[model samples]
Target: MRMLRQLLYRLIISLRTFRKKGLRAGFAELGRTISRIFYQRAEFIVIARALLEQIPPAASKQGLVIRRATTREEIASLSPIADMIDMARFHKMFDHGSFAFIAFQNDQPVGYCWVSEEVDRNVTRVQPPLHPGDACVHDLFVSPAHRGRRIGRALVSHRLRFLREHGYKRALAVVRRDNVPALKVDKKTGYTNIGEMSHTRILFWDSFRYNIPDA
Candidate 1:
């Protein structure tokens, strides 16, 4: 089912590219899409570390309201805007006591991010294993139309503050090596590059190897 959805998305993209560019461009895009879905691909993931003291004190969103998501209504409100998370996963995160920070602009959802506050409990998706006093932050996203406005940076800053206020000693954020925007946001929020990871997927299974500095 997941693969089918991916193929469907690719098909839609290819068609759009075809309509806008030409047949040659569409075929090239489709070929690349198929290769990605079926062939082995190398993915670089970066691990960043942040201490509580690293959070910026002046981190604030201009004309935007952000808060912890604590209600089913908020989950429903985010399902359409957040592409990476689903309704079921949102409920599970809530049940596990891992809450999300939702950002809204003029009553419309613009961006959101999630944090696993408890290192030991209800953490269904953690990689490289979290150490004591360590928490994982994942899936920070902003609407495309709202990009270039620093909304993502503000969202990450807000999340870091949340972790600091909750007394967590350390926070770990995983970002792809090619995600320039996320890397910039994480850096601006006082996170430092600590390690790199190589990832590859074979069918449904993924394998990762960590490369800590000096390790």
Candidate 2:
């Protein structure tokens, strides 16, 4: 009954979005929202500066090069991962202080991830207060053809090292409980489960939100 009610609510929102933004935009937003609600059961994890030293050095895979994206061309090459947004919006994210790391395999872009030191309270659903030394990792994606390789591990390790070098003391990430692969990768990179959070939304408004105590 609860699931049915949620579906009906989502249908209403999608219809409204369609009238305002057209079918493509409305369906895309609906898909993203549904996916989030489906994965609402998530774990929040944090890695301390001390654990940074304990993490094993990321293995160097042949033909794989991981580096921070600094150019529009490099960012544009990440279209596979950022297909949901236009190039203009992608540039805006960079302009807003969200940094990206791109993975290339023999010159072909395969995967990428993004990190931000400050929360964009206006855009993000969950506005967790970030301390001076804390950074959040989000939007980690790997191409279907490149799964099972430790590309994600390397990307995460690179981000953590970058944060530590810049004087940050901790890194935080959220992973859906059902996403076993992501959970394993984060654990392998030394992130400890810290807590959990879930958000409930009706139309455009968040109805309920709370954190779960760690067991």
Candidate 3:
């Protein structure tokens, strides 16, 4: 009787352990499957407008106001605070770079875009150096609720004109293949593709290489 009881206890414990392991494994696989499905396609349209004469509202039809960001505070207003590293680093870049354009509606910042320039330099080695005369589009974002009304396009168009006036021969922006909206925007904007899609293995606190795909 004693022997039977001991065996029964061990069997119960073994069964519980097996069940727990199976649950964990299933969840892990489910997470991977979900990620795979999400990344399988592009997301977001990156439209380019000629120039915004007015600020577009989140709901009611209102004009969008677009202009160059002259101060860190101005840039901060446009930033979504999605990542502190991006915010801090861009502030630093603003000091070093030339133009940082921002868009607003009713005096409230709606979107922002910037271009980094190296006029005479042959190339910039960022992890893997970018070619000389290539002006990189640093930041481009429209508020989640305020997108689809050409706000992003206007900001980008304004920046492009600024870059052209400043003598930038070409512009470059790295987009994740999964960003469908951005891809569409680029296509409509007359910005051609140039490849340099190598991942930087280095990680930093609050550093985001690209925006996560919106579901």
**Candidate that scores best on lDDT:** 1
lDDT of 2 by residue, 64-129 (tens): 898899977878888765542334445666778888899999888888888877877443434344
List the RMSD of every prediction in angstroms.
4.2, 7.4, 15.0
Which stretches of model 1 miss by more than 4 angstroms?
1-37, 40-42, 57-61, 84-97, 117-126, 213-215
Best prediction by TM-score: 1
- Per-residue lDDT over 78-165 for candidate 3, one digit per residue giving the tens place of the 0 to 100 score: 5553344356456667667645777777787777776666421212223212355556674577777778888777776667767666
Candidate 1, 42-124: lDDT as tens digits? 54555655564656644445778888888878777896675332555666777777778888988888989888755432334
Better of 1 and 2 by lDDT: 1
Query: For residue 5, what is the lDDT in candidate 1?
Result: 59
lDDT of each: 0.72, 0.69, 0.54
Ranking by TM-score: 1, 2, 3
Each candidate's number of clashing pairs is 0, 0, 21
The model with the greater TM-score, 2 or 3, is: 2
Deviation from native of the Cα of residue 144 in model 2, angstroms: 1.0
Q: How accurate is candidate 2 locally (lDDT)?
A: 0.69
Worst 10 residues of 2 by lDDT: 42-51
